[model samples]
Target chain A: MSLLSVRDLTVKFSNRGQSVTALNGISFDIARGERVGVVGESGAGKSITGFAMMNLLSRPGYIDGGQVLFEGKDVLKMSAREQRSLRGNRMAMIFQDPMVTLNPVLTIGQQMVETLRAHRKLSHEEARQIATVKLKEVYIPSPEARLDQYPHELSGGMRQRIVIAMALLLDPQLIIADEPTTALDVTIQADIMELLLEMCRSNMVGLMLITHDLGVVSQVTERTLVMYAGRIIEAGKTRSIINDPQHPYTQGLINALPQQTPPGSRLKQIPGSMPSLNAMPSGCPFHPRCPLANDLCRTTMPKVVQYADVEVACHEVQRLQSDLTSEAAQ
Target chain B: MLQYTFRRTIAVLPTILCLIVICFFLMRLAPGGPFTSERPLPPAIMANVLERYGLDQPLYVQLFTYLKNIFFNFDFGPSFAQRDRDVNDIIAAGFPVTLTYGFWSAVFVLVLGIPLGVIAALRQNSFWDYVMTGFAIFSQIFPNFVLAPLMVLTFTLALGLLPGGGWNGGQWEYVVMPAVALGTSYLANVARITRSSLLEVLGSPYIRTARAKGLPERTIMIRHALKPTLLPVISYMSPVFVYMITGSVFIDVFFSTGGIGQSFIDAAYTRDYSVILGLAILYSVLTFVLNLAVDLAYAAIDPKVRSGLK
Candidate 1:
């Protein structure tokens, strides 16, 4: 069974007397030990998906309709206590900014021990030992000394390592990291991502990484989902999607990468910004900026269709594929 | 930490000196003397009285002598208006009452105000939040002078559940009316501050991480949210606490509580130089000390401040 299966998940917010749909119906699944990367531009509801899956959306925002089935049990149907137990223990989350993830007033050890004791009945010593071990696992030197230090005492890279250690304390089956290294320097980001990937691989823990950096995703994730305007526009094996993008939007994202342009040449970019949720366009959300948009694309949302190993949601892709097949037959 | 404390302690000396000079000069600047009575005394008798207290000396001599006496013996001198009583004796007798009243009121402010604020912030736009917001606004609008009488009328006359006014040897019943009267505005201030600060903290990324950690709501609030929320509240409450202790003159008069607050007002009205100067110096010292304590508490609770000190 898949470790997490999020099907037809929709999240909405009643912001300022107007209903805003932040995440339209989207479906995906992660099996044990699988690593999936969710890549999108800002405001594409990437972080909201992580929060909604954990049932952590607060105020104004609500899970309008969805099924988040974890281990064959619907999360929406779970009692508060059950959800609490499943959280931190079975599924954990790492955040973007390390400085903000750890409580400022709490010592490193205290925070880690608190997480452990919350889900299990463990003595302070036992929890502290586990915390120290996890800190060592994240390659923190003098882990024992670090337990007594506060978040502000650590460097940015060290703080992120401490956050990762806290997330692993309970040995969660699935970890949802939302832009976990976005706040760090480039060198630190590489080390942190490598450490995370190695840790997940050794423990066979499933990871759902949400990021805007295509480079980071290509290195760490097996499968990739490209989101646009609150919907999944394309998804496939990371290698296939990166190498052979079917949807025009996905193609635009890959082309816009810095490496795709020659030196001294201006980089390519999508024509328009993502639409505001309150004033979203009809039909395909990406049609306004899509180079291949047609009449059907502007009038109706396209259904997802399989293109080889990839699933793409664009009418132009279907036409191109058929045209290529007919030309090959001739 | 030790160096910080020592530096802070040394910093109080110049503050106290400045306070002493200002209070002494200001008290002398006022229009009347301590012995100004309905009928003027004979010149001979006044001369004798002035000589008895060394008031006949030059202003600089008197000021220097007063400073010398306090520095060497810690004496605040005898009350010029009250017979056979010293400033120290009056403060010793009266300050305890004020402290008790202030302490109890602070208890009310913390016990009632903080939880109310936390709940209001957590609930946000709910009915309970609306009710608490209304209560906070109402309390702030009506100052203690206005609230005290209203409380007395209701609790003392209408319900007749408690005494209207009296110290009553620090009985719990006597304390209830005065504490509530003194604490209402402070409670309102604290609640409003807590609610706003906590609301901001609740939106922080750490709070979101806490929620994601699967910890219970109570744990997330107390463990993750409350400390940062209190950073601003602590700084705000320090001055409020000193104000409660030293600025309760109206409450003291209304409740007939024999606290130093009443003595302060009486000394001010009577133009008793020694008593007024002594109390002013005491309040200045208290304010400095309380502010230092708040800073130390801030450093202890916030890692950023603590590390900055190092």
Candidate 2:
């Protein structure tokens, strides 16, 4: 069984008396030690999925319908105490913008030990000992000294490392990192990503990586889900999805990478911007920006249909798969 | 921190000296002497009074002597407005009254305002939040002049829950109305500041991270959000704090509390130079000391500002 299973999860926002779908029946799963990436543009609800999984969605954005099963128990049905126990103990989250992720007023040691003591009945001295070990595991220099220092005393990269260390402090089975390296310098991004991936692998931890950077996704994720609007447009093995994207929107995202274009030339971009959530386009949410969008695509929301290695929700991809099968038989 | 406080303290001496020179010369510049009255005094009586107080000397000589008396003899001279009473005598009697109300009002404002702010922030658009916001705005609009009397009428005459006026030698019961009246402004200010400040900090990514850490909402608020929320609130406090501690003329006069604030106002009306100058020195000194304390507080709260403070 999968370590985390999100079954037909739906999130909605009721703004000014009208309810808009933010995450529309999105379903996916992560087995133990698996690494999955969810990618999309700014308003694509990528972070919402991560937040919903933890039941930490801010007000107005709520779980309209969903079953977030953690180790076979539905997290949505758990009591507040039960959920609290599960979060940061069985599962943890690492947020973007390390510069602001840790409490400015708290010392590194205080933040770390509180998290440890939250889930387990540990002495302050015991928690401190565990925190030192986690910090050392993340390659922090002089872990003991670092504990006494405040968040502002550290650099952005070091702060991120500390955040990652905090996530791993309680030996959680799953770690959800939302654009963890996006706020760091370009030179530092690769180092942080590598450290995170290495830590996850060595700890045998399931990782849910959410970001818009396809290049980073390809490097760290084994499986990838491409989201458009609030639904998953396409999902498959990261390698196949990056090399030969099935959905029209996925193709645009993968092709739009700078490396996909020759140097010094304008990079390819999807024609229209994402539709506003309240004013979402009818049928397939990606149909407006989809190059192969048709009357069927505009009229009916595509269902997730499976191919041999991919599960995609696009009418064109569905037709193309049939045509390829027929041509192969002939 | 020690070095920063020391350097900041040294910086205040010149500022206080500058205030003294400007006030000393400006008070003399006004077309009134310490002996000025609507009904002119007999020429002989005025001359005798002027010479008695050494006001008959050259303006510069009088200023030098005033400075020398203040710095060397620690004498603030006798009050020209009040007969036979010196400036020092007034301060000695009034300062303690101000201190009593000042300490209590501060305690009242902080105790009531901070928690109210945190509750409002936590319940952003709830009914209670709206009520607090409304009350904060209402308090801000009503100055102590208006508030002090209403409180007297309601708490004294109408409800009869407490005394109307009089310090009664700094008794708690007598102090309540004045402190509450004086604190109304600060209470409102602190609530609004804390509400907005905590909301901003709550929206910050750090607070979100704390939430993500599986901390209970209470823990997240008290531990992670409180200190940063307090930073701006603390900054707003420095000047207001010194003034409150020294005294507010309204509180002193309305409550019939003998305080330096009331003395300063009376001396200004009567052109009591020694009294005015002495109070000015006290205010400037208090302002400088409180500001330095605020900087040190910033250092204690955020190590990032510690180096900048020094």
Top-TM-score candidate index: 2
In model 1, residue pairs whose N, Cα or C atoms come closer than 3 Å (at least 3 residues apart or on different chains), thus clashing, are none
Cα lDDT over the full model 1: 0.90
Each prediction's whole-model lDDT (CA): 0.90, 0.90
Cα error, residue B204 of model 2, in Å, equals 1.9
Poorest 10 consecutive residues by lDDT, candidate 1 chain A: A315-324
lDDT (tens digit, per residue) of candidate 2 on A1-330: 999999999999998899999999999999999999999999998999999999998878889997999999999999999999888899999999988888888899999999999989999999999999999999999999999998888999999999999999999999999999899999999999999999999999999999999989999999999998889888999998988888888889878888889999999998989999889888888888877889998889988888757899989878888898999999
Residue pairs clashing in model 2 are none
Give the per-residue lDDT digits (tens) of candidate 1, residues A93-207: 9999998788889899888888899899999999999999999999999999999998888999999999888888899999999999999999899999999999899999999
Task: Write one digit per residue (lDDT tens) for candidate 1, span B166-204.
Answer: 887889898888888889988987888899999999999
TM-score for each of the candidates: 0.95, 0.96
| DockQ, every prediction | 0.77, 0.80
Worst 10 residues of 1 chain B by lDDT: B243-252
